[model samples]
Target: MDPTNSSTSLAFEVAVFNPSIIVGPVVLGALVDTCLFGCLVIQTYVYYANFANDHRAIRFTVAAVFATQIAHVMCVSATLWNTAVSAYDDPSKLQMLPLASAATILFTGITGALVESYFAFRLWNVSKKLLLPILSMVLCVIAQVVSLVITVQAFKTTSVAEFEVDQNTPITLALTSRVLCDLILTLSTAWYLKNQRSGYLRTTNMIDRLVLWTIETGLITRYDERRRSWRV
Candidate 1:
C-alpha cells in the first residue's frame, strides 16, 4: 500500500474505534453496580443469618430482592461483554441494542419497585395510614409499567440512537415516578416517626436518627435516578 493511503486508513480506523461516548459510561456503571451488588450480598447474608426470626413475608421480600439483584448484575455483565468483548472489532455492533440491555432495564425496574413497595408496606404497618402506602404503590406500578414499555421498545429498536429517541418519554416518566415514590415514602415515614415522639430523651434521639436514615436512603436513590434521567 502507498504510505499516504495507509496513514489515511489508519486514522480512519482510529476514529472509528472511539467508544468513549457510548461504552465508557456503561463500563463505569457496571463497575459501580458490581460494587453495590457486593454490598447487597453482605447485607442479605446478615439479614438471613441474624434476622431469621423475622416475619415470613418480610423474609420472602428480602429473598426476592436479592434474586432480582443477581439477575440485574448478570444482565449488566452480559451487556458489558457483548459491547466490550464480542463487538470489539465491529464498532457498528455497539450501535445496536443487545438482548441483555433490555433484560437489564426490566430487572432494574423490578428491583426498584420491589424495594419501594416493601418500604411502603412497612410505612403503612407503622403509621396505620392507607393513603401514603396506596400512593406509593401506585407510583411504583406506573414506574414498572413504563419500564416494561421501554424494554419492549428496546427490543424493536435497530440502533441505540433510535432507542433513545423513541423511548425518551417513557424513560422520563419512569424516572420521575420512581423519584416521586421515594420522596413520598421517605417523607411520610419521617413525618409519622416524628409524631411518635415520647417523653424520654433517648426515644426522641432515636426518632431523629431514624428520620435521618430515611432521608439519606431516599435521597441517594432519588439522586441516582435523577442523574440517570439527565444522562438519558
Candidate 2:
C-alpha cells in the first residue's frame, strides 16, 4: 500500500487484477470511439449549417443526439481511466464501485433510447400511425429503466460475477428489449419505405436511401449490444 511501491513494484508488470489484452483493447476502442465521435461532431456541424436553418425541431434533435453521444464518450473515457490507472496497484480498487458502471450504463441507455426514439418518430411520420411507433418507444423506455436497475444491483453486489448473477434477469430483460426494439425499428422503417416504392424513379430511389440508412442504424445498434454483453 506504500505510495512509492506503485511506482517501483507494479510499474513493470501487469497487475493481477487485469489481463494483458484488457487495457489495449479498451484504449483502442476508446480511440475508435473518439474518432467516430469527431465524425459525428462534423456531421452535426454540417447539419446545423444546412438542415437546421429551416427546421427548429430537427435542429433540437440533432443537438440532443450530439450531446448525449458526447456524454457517452466521456463516460467511456472515465471508465478506461479507472480500469487502467486507478487500480494499478490496489487490488481493492479493482472491485466494482458501482459509480463508474452506473454512470456509463445510464449514459449509454439514454443515448440508445434517444436514437431509437428518433427513428421511431420517423417511422410514425411515414406510417401515419401510432400503433407500432408507440410500442417501440415503450420498449426503449423499458430498456433504459432496466439498465438503471442493473446499475443499482451492481452496487449491491460484491463482485463482478456476483453482480452479473444477481442481475441476470434484469440484464437479460434489458438486452432482449434493446434487440427487439432495434429489430422493430429497422424492419418497420424498411417495410414502410418498401411500401412507398412507386413507379416513379426519383421517389423509389429516395426510399431506397432511407431503407439503407435504417439498416445501417440497426447494424450499429446490434454491434453496440454485442460490445456491452461481451464483458467477462
Candidate 3:
C-alpha cells in the first residue's frame, strides 16, 4: 500500500474511535433512564392516590422509592449535559461529573437496597426467622458498596473506557449479587406464601394470585437491574 494512503486510513480510524462516539451511547442510555423514571413517577403517584387506605408503612415505602428515583433522574440528566453539551466539541472533556455521577450511583444503590430490604421484611414476616432476612440484607450491602465504588472509580478515571477496563469485575459481580438477592427473596417469599394456602378454593386462588404478583415483580425488577448495570 502507498504510504500516504496508509497514513490517511489510520487517521480515519482514529477519528472514528473518538471518545465522543463512545459517549453518545451513554447519553442515549441516560435519556432512556429519564423516560423510565418518569413512568415510575406516574405509577407511584397513581398508586398513592388510589390506595390512600393502604398501610402507613406501604405508603412510606412507595414515597421513598419515588423520591430516590426522582433524585436519580435529576442527577443523571445533569451528568448527561455536563458530559455532552457543556463539553461539546471536545472529546477530552468527556469525563464524568463527580457530583452528579456520584449522586446517581448512590441513589441507585440506595434504591436497590431499599427494595431488597423491603422484600426481606416480607420474608421476615413469613418465616419469623432472622437468618434468611439477614442474608438478603448482607447481599444488598455488598451490592451497594460495589456499586458506589464503581461510580467513584469511574469519576476518578479519565474516561468510561478506562473505568470499564479497571472495574469490570466489580461491575459484573455487583449486578450478579443484586439479581441473585432479588431472586432469592422472590422464591423464598413465594414458597412460604404458597405453603400458607388452606386448600379452600377462594383462599387458594388468592394465594396463587399473590405468588404470581411476586414472581412478576421479581422478574421485572431483576431484568431491569441487569439492563441498567450492563449500560453502566
Candidate 4:
C-alpha cells in the first residue's frame, strides 16, 4: 500500500472510532437517565400534590431525585465531551471533570439509596424479629459501598481511555449495586404489603403503590436492555 493512502485510511479509522466511542454509550445513557428523571419528577409532584399533609417525606425524596438527575446530566455531558476530546488530544484535560462528576453521582446514589432504605425500614417497622429488614438494610449499605468504590476509582485514574475501554466492569458493578439495593427494598416492601394489617387504608395504599412503581421503573425496568437489542 502507498504510504500516503495508508496514513489517510488510518486517520479516517481513528475519526470514526473516536466519535463512536463518545456518542454511543454516553448518548444512550444520558437519554435514558434524563427521561427517567423527568418521569420521576412528574410522579413525585403528583404524589406530593395529592398528599399535601405528607410533604416532608415526599419533598425529601423529590430533592434527592432532582439531585441525582442533575448529577447524571453532568456526568453524562462531561464524560462525552472528555471522551471526544481525548480521542485526538492529550488525555490529561479529562482529569478533574470525571472526578467532580463521580463525586456528584456518588452523592446522588447514596442519598437516593437512603431514601428507599428508610421507607423500607418504615414499612417493616411492625416485624417482630426485624431480621429480614436488617438484612435488607445491610445489602443497601454494601451496595452503596461497591458503587462508590467503583465510580470513584474509575474517575480518579489518569487516563479515562483505559476506564472507558474497560467501562463494563465499573458500570456493571454500579448497576449491580443499584439493582440489589432496589431488589432488597422491593422485596421488603412486598413482605410488608402482604403483612399489612387491616388498619392500613385510604391514602396509605396509594402511597405504597406509588413508591413501589417508582422504584420499579427506575431500577427493575428492562427498557434499556430492550432498546439495546433493537439497536443490535
Across 46-142, the per-residue lDDT of candidate 4 in tens digits comes to 8777876775865676667666666766766666666555534764353223554566567666765767677656656656547666776676676
How big is the positional error of residue 64 in model 4, measured in Å on the Cα after superposition?
A: 2.9
lDDT of 2 by residue, 47-147 (tens): 77777556777677778889888887887788778767886786455545436555667777877887898899999998999998999989999998999
Better of 1 and 3 by TM-score: 1
Model 3 agreement with the true structure over 1-232: per-residue lDDT tens digits: 8999988855654554457555677699798998899799789879978999998988898889989998998898888887778778866566433467767877898899889989999999998988888888888889999998887776676544446557889989899989989988999998888777544667879999999999999999999999999999
Per-prediction TM-score: 0.77, 0.70, 0.68, 0.59
lDDT of 3: 0.81
For model 1 the TM-score comes to 0.77
Tens digits of per-residue lDDT, candidate 1, 1-232, equal: 7999978855654555446677888899899999999999999999999999999999999999999999999999999998899889987788778999999999999899889989998899879989999999999999999999898888787567667667888999999999999999999998887776543567879899999999999999999999999999
Off by over 4 Å in 4: 1-22, 55-58, 83-101, 126-129, 164-177, 195-232
Tell me how far the alpha carbon of residue 180 in candidate 3 is from the true structure, in angstroms, after superposition.
Answer: 0.9
Clash pairs for candidate 1: none
Regions more than 4 Å wrong, model 3: 1-21, 95-98, 197-232
For every model shown, the clashing-pair count is 0, 0, 0, 0
Comparing 2 with 4 on TM-score, the higher-scoring candidate is: 2
